[model samples]
Target: MGFEELEPIFGELNVERAGEGSVPSRRFLYHVHAADPSHLRIIVTDFHSNAWEAVRSIVQLEDMRDNIGIGGSWLEFIDYVLASIKSQDAKLILEGGLDTVSGAANAKLVAQKSKGMPVISISLTELVGSAASAAITNLSLELFKAFKSIHDLYREEKELSNQLTKALAAEKERNENIQSQLEQYSKGKKLQKISSSDKADASALLNNGLENSPEKQTPRDTALTKVANRVVPVYRRARVRGVTLQDTEDIEDE
Candidate 1:
């Protein structure tokens, strides 16, 4: 890429320093200086091919244009840089443990600081690769696990709701049955009371007839016989309705 075209994308460049720079046993090398206010430095070291072209390939991506070209956050820029390099299949090491450093020449500082921060190191040959793949994979797995856990909880809640509904239905049915039985008991008691009253009236009528009859034994006997025929039939009907003889006698005495 022409220096005029690359300047707008990468900001200022030190051509003299980059051209003269050399890393031991490396044939191709490229270093992209991060724009102001960010401490990120992207260094590509290729032993067999052109590393500068790899940076150019990354610069052409739509993501690079949207993130780096359009003035996005440092985090977004870092992601774009990482993805771009991985697409090139360049073997490199990623270290977030990197502090605010001026140059890529200080490998010692980057290594020492790596121990202090969360770091994932991957590389092919001496050139280290990006840790993006591992980070993305872990995040995706955790999201999936969280989704499954929530789904299970919802299913359990539904089952419990169903059980509670069934229990309530059963309880309602029991209440209705109890109410029906109470009604039947009340009707039976009412019929018993009516039968007892009838038996009492019949006994009272027989007593009145005998008392009103003549004092002579023959007339009193005839009156008693007439009352007995009518009263006995009514008393028998009461008995058929479940009024016991003892119950009828108790009513007559009362």
Candidate 2:
């Protein structure tokens, strides 16, 4: 692809076109410097008549200090690419064709890699022909839409998980409050039982004391008997001073 068309794809990235003599087999070599320390070099080969025929399509990574280094072989580079993708730390994407045998093999490797990350595959053959340019643009747009959908779904899942956690915590707190209330109610019932027992015991002791007393009288009964004895003598003296039955009989005889 021309620099003008590729510029929009790799915006703000440092892009350099390799000299024709640098890699004779490859038609175009695009060296792309990403924002991070790692860089990508995509090597595109001429299209063959047979789609299954092996094309010299290759991808090279530079200064990939965090990943394992590989040799110049296309297979080794594919392995390294997959390894980088699997590592989950890759910041750059180097899309290549999948029509040729080697390119198809690399696509299979990418497919076999673990998920939870995005992988975009673009065919170099489609980019060359004027008729296929529209298809390529559509494919790129679809890839972006897929990435955005995945991002939105991930955010939704995170929000649901957070809400579930909050609900569980609130349920636990409510259960704790209910448990505390139950415990307090149990303690209050126990105290009421103890108070009732104390009252019964006091009544029993008072009854026993009255039954064991010498006169079978409680303290209150004894005090009332003393008052009665003192008032009875006073009443008998007043009756005697008022009139005798013998004096009434003598008066009746006279």
Candidate 3:
């Protein structure tokens, strides 16, 4: 939705976006909006995940913003998130060789002004309490991992269900196809018997073949073939796919 819909979520978070100058090693809460809900409704790119780790805070965030970010007006929320890092006796201690995080021209200028030491000034863009941001970031990452795992499992189950449904349909079709072929063979046999036999015997045999003998003759009918240019087949497939319909002794008679 729009900013109005986000206001309630922001109210829950009780914080806003922290900048690059947030260097106080304490805790603070903040929120960052992602995108529209309908198109891609995922709540990724949260401030709670990337904030403290991006700036590496050792302390917690709860100790930082006092009555600052939430349930208050917009100006109060901004004031809560935006604060310069005031390091009281927190000067950088260069333990070893000169290690500057930045190699910019302005850093060189500041270093020249501060004697031969490399310039290491805090950037005004960081947030107020880094440790708090980092804690939120850790929690958010765990949630995301859990969400992804659930999503993957759901997809796998759906795929398996679809495959099972397809297999069942194919089996049903194959059974119906074999049944039709068997009926055709039985009808052909009955017609031939009628042409050669007398009235009563012919009728009885035809009725018997249609009823009691239909299922029994399926395998036998499949084994015989019509002429294909006086050869076994124009093209032949193995009987590996055939469904058995006869008793062993009866089939051996063929």
lDDT tens digits, residues 155-211, model 3? 999999999999999999999999999999999999988866777787888888877
Q: TM-score for all predictions?
A: 0.33, 0.38, 0.28
Q: How accurate is candidate 2 locally (lDDT)?
A: 0.42
Q: Supply the TM-score for candidate 2.
A: 0.38
Considering every candidate listed, which one attains the maximal lDDT? 1
Candidate 3 Cα misplacement greater than 4 A, ranges: 1-128, 196-254
Name the better of 1 and 3 by TM-score. 1
- Residue-level lDDT of model 1, residues 1-254, one tens digit each, is 22222221211111122233322433333344333322333443332321221223334434434532435653454454444433322323222222311223322101111233222222211232333333334334544665778899999999999999999999999999999999999999999999999999999999888877676358668778788877547777877899545676788899
lDDT winner between 2 and 3, please give it: 2
Q: Model 3 residue 48 lDDT?
A: 33
